[model samples]
Target: MSAVASETKTRQLPYVVAITEGVREVLKEQANAFVAGEDVAGAGSVYGYYRGLLDEFGADRIYDTPISEKGIIGLGVGAAAAGLRPVLDIMFMDFIGECMDEIANQMAKMRFMFGGSATLPITVLTMAGAGANLAAQHSQSLEAWLAHLPGLKVVMPATPYDAKGLIIAAARDDNPVFVVLNKMSLAMMGDVPEGPYEVPIGKANVVRTGKNYTIVTLGRMLGQALDAAKQLAELGIDAEVIDARSVQPFDTEAVIKSVEKTHRAMVVHEAVRFGGFGAEIAAQIQEHAFDYLDAPVARVGAPFSPVPFSPALEKVYVPNAERIVVVAREQLGI
Candidate 1:
């Protein structure tokens, strides 16, 4: 069993359901918290994670807005600034382009621009990743964009547990937080604790322990990395797998500690390899654990092309366990 699946006692739930529960719990906990986005209430979200939320919370708390991404985010920024905790939905991660000004300039820099006098306790949830053939426009893992901005917390949850926990944690945080979710993993199931719980932002989870190598993965790549670890184990390689749940306030200590022990590290993500967050992680590893490294840190990610619409092309576009194994062997020379 995988490290996450090995845990017992917690009930199993789909990643999509966990998100619903997380948002529901957040609204229940925070009286001022409200959910706003296009088709979120009536459509129960384009992914069904927000299903039944309208019936449960009513329109006062759950709102369905127009199809304007900028307006949706603008409303969220204004509402959050006015002392209400808003859980805004940016239907698709790619839609962030429409609201970059609200996100980058207003939501991200407002608190700092005001010298900590203002707090934007906003949680922006958006779907990312390339699978289910959503194509380039709809299926881009753009977490790097949000992570690059200052004063914004970026988190990518790979499993159902992290999805629910991270969402709740993001909602509770005082600063603006982006819960970058994977649309392809919505149907994936995992053990999740019941009720409101936090997975804590800025912390990395070492899912699989090994002595030889460390494979730090972000978002949906956690499963692929674990699969690759299993494949490597068959060939006399023990690989430690770390889930980088949060990227901006990255858990450098966890990754550095792992690299210090294993003396070899690689970072992987679904974003474009040219300037993905993997580059940032690889750089951090070299800086913090240069003496411990036995080889240059490796990175695995997609090509710098747009996500393909065809299933055949997408299968080749997105990085998989085979690609990870190939890169690992080339880097480790084994």
Candidate 2:
């Protein structure tokens, strides 16, 4: 990402297009790679993310399957073991519960169980986040649940650029990775490279920098935290914002360095506060950067409950700039 190339950028595409383009690029390069899921073929995908993949790859490479989560995971796990890269499409990550055994045991452990002889280059593409009023089942950010499991690489991309780059990276890895795309940021337009690229996994991006405080978050929550950081500047408070893009292989070193500089840290997410993924991050920050803290680490998230169907209730349930501001103020005793 050079200045001349970044400034010379010609195309800005919607978030979904980046994904479609990445998959298209990979399918063109890798003969053994194919996409499989219900309604993914044709233009029947829930988010229209795979709208044109079928036309490019043909019916053989882009094929549909029964509406079964177990079948989808099984297909990907078996295909990967047999030396093919299968991007299994799980419409909503919330549906992971439908095939937990297949995911938790088969796909996540096949390589390890086979003494490193088997490679499950399986990338599970799914949508998450609490907006669109799709209710609890259709809309939820379940990264924590997947990240808790060993032998799985969980990736959540916040921007269109990362969406494309990380997709390419995840597809190339031998580990089973969960590519969790947030629906809330689907329509966001941003500068994207024309060809495929890789954003290294297990790294965090410092989206904004300041000396007074640090805000670590990802997905839709990163936008809200940035908004809060901007407002915090009005009152003469400088805040650094970090996007922990890949949660499982989290960039703890980056976060610790930020905390060491700012002396205060806040973790935010759209998921519920209790036992949420932020807790894991907060604990890590405390462990590695405890002496640098001027105040206890603060976490801002929705209340512990199912995602509300009502848009009004849902708005309050998810973390917002106002809540973030209040929580940051409380953390600093301002």
Candidate 3:
């Protein structure tokens, strides 16, 4: 094993660094594991998450590829089918359009298509969200697009802890998992365990507990919901924040249980409010917990338009904590 792979640090690191640590750990234990992405080794990735991985694991394990999402995803799909675990670092989630066949058809359906005789453990690490002002082409929270596909496990980690655990779990799973790391949360830091661990896929995390209402959100919106919860507390309103980390194998039970207790629920996300994935959660909560609700489940998300390029417009484009607070108030009839 390389020196970087051998040494494990216990100190707190940013979300990106924690992800790097997870990659390093995965490569060490799984000798068949390799990371391939555009500019990953040459430029330390488009986001600097793999800065020191190339030097530690050498060019063979951690390397760059053509500026092609199709090629990178193809490599992962092919390598995974041949008994090698490969993680494709798609620079931006928006680029998923370039390799829909490889992802939605090939990687996603490999094991099932092979009659369960194969283990296609391919992890596609991609960035999602619109806070960086990279224009519409570069900035988009496309988790909803991938979640709609079958045979794919989708995870959106909002904290450093979930980032590392989910990626590690995705790497080790015998199925294709998309690790949708939000760009806005890359710098957000939290206490991450030193040893190898997993937050477990298909689970919901209740970051804050309250009895009045339940806030179901994931990725960057999770932080916004938590912040809104504190402000709602001042108004004698208790809000429970549920981080729907695994969007595909969604933990509907946890959400239903929360709503059953609170009798109210709100769904929030950074994606476009219209036709966004939040609509799915809202529908499910209402369908399963309808009898326990006091009012219709509210949703908070971006406006129904392309993400703006200008900083001022982008600021208004993404959902914020204040909007969640306002929606919560409206639901309470306050």
Off by over 4 Å in 1: 1-9
Error of 3 at 171 (Å): 0.6
Error of 2 at 79 (Å): 0.5
lDDT of 2 by residue, 1-334 (tens): 3222554454799999998877887788788999999789976487898887888779878878889999999999988889999988999889999999999998888778889999888888899988789998988888888888889999888988888878888898888988899998889998888876777778998999899799999677888999999999987789999999999899999999999999999999888788888999999999999999999999998898999999998888888899999998888878
Model 3, residue 96: distance off in Å is 0.4
Per-residue error at 237 for model 1, in Å?
Answer: 1.2
- Give the deviation of candidate 2 from the true structure as CA RMSD: 1.6
User: Model 1 — TM-score against the truth?
Assistant: 0.97
Estimate TM-scores for all models: 0.97, 0.97, 0.95
10 residues in a row with least lDDT, candidate 2: 1-10
lDDT of 1 by residue, 93-204 (tens): 9999999999999999999989988989999999999977989999999988889999999999999999999999999999899999999899999988777788899999
User: Any idea what lDDT model 1 has?
Assistant: 0.93
Error of model 3, residue 291, in angstroms: 0.6
Q: Count the backbone clashes (under 3 Å) in each candidate.
A: 0, 0, 0
lDDT of 3: 0.88
- Residue-level lDDT tens digits of model 3 in 1-334: 0122346565678999988888888988889999999888878887898888888889889878988888898888888878899988999888999999988888878778889887789888999899898989888998888899889999999888889889888998888999999888888878777878777889989989898889999788999998899999999989999999999999999999999999999999998998889999999988898899999999998898888999999998889999998888888888
TM-score of candidate 2 against the unseen true structure:
0.97
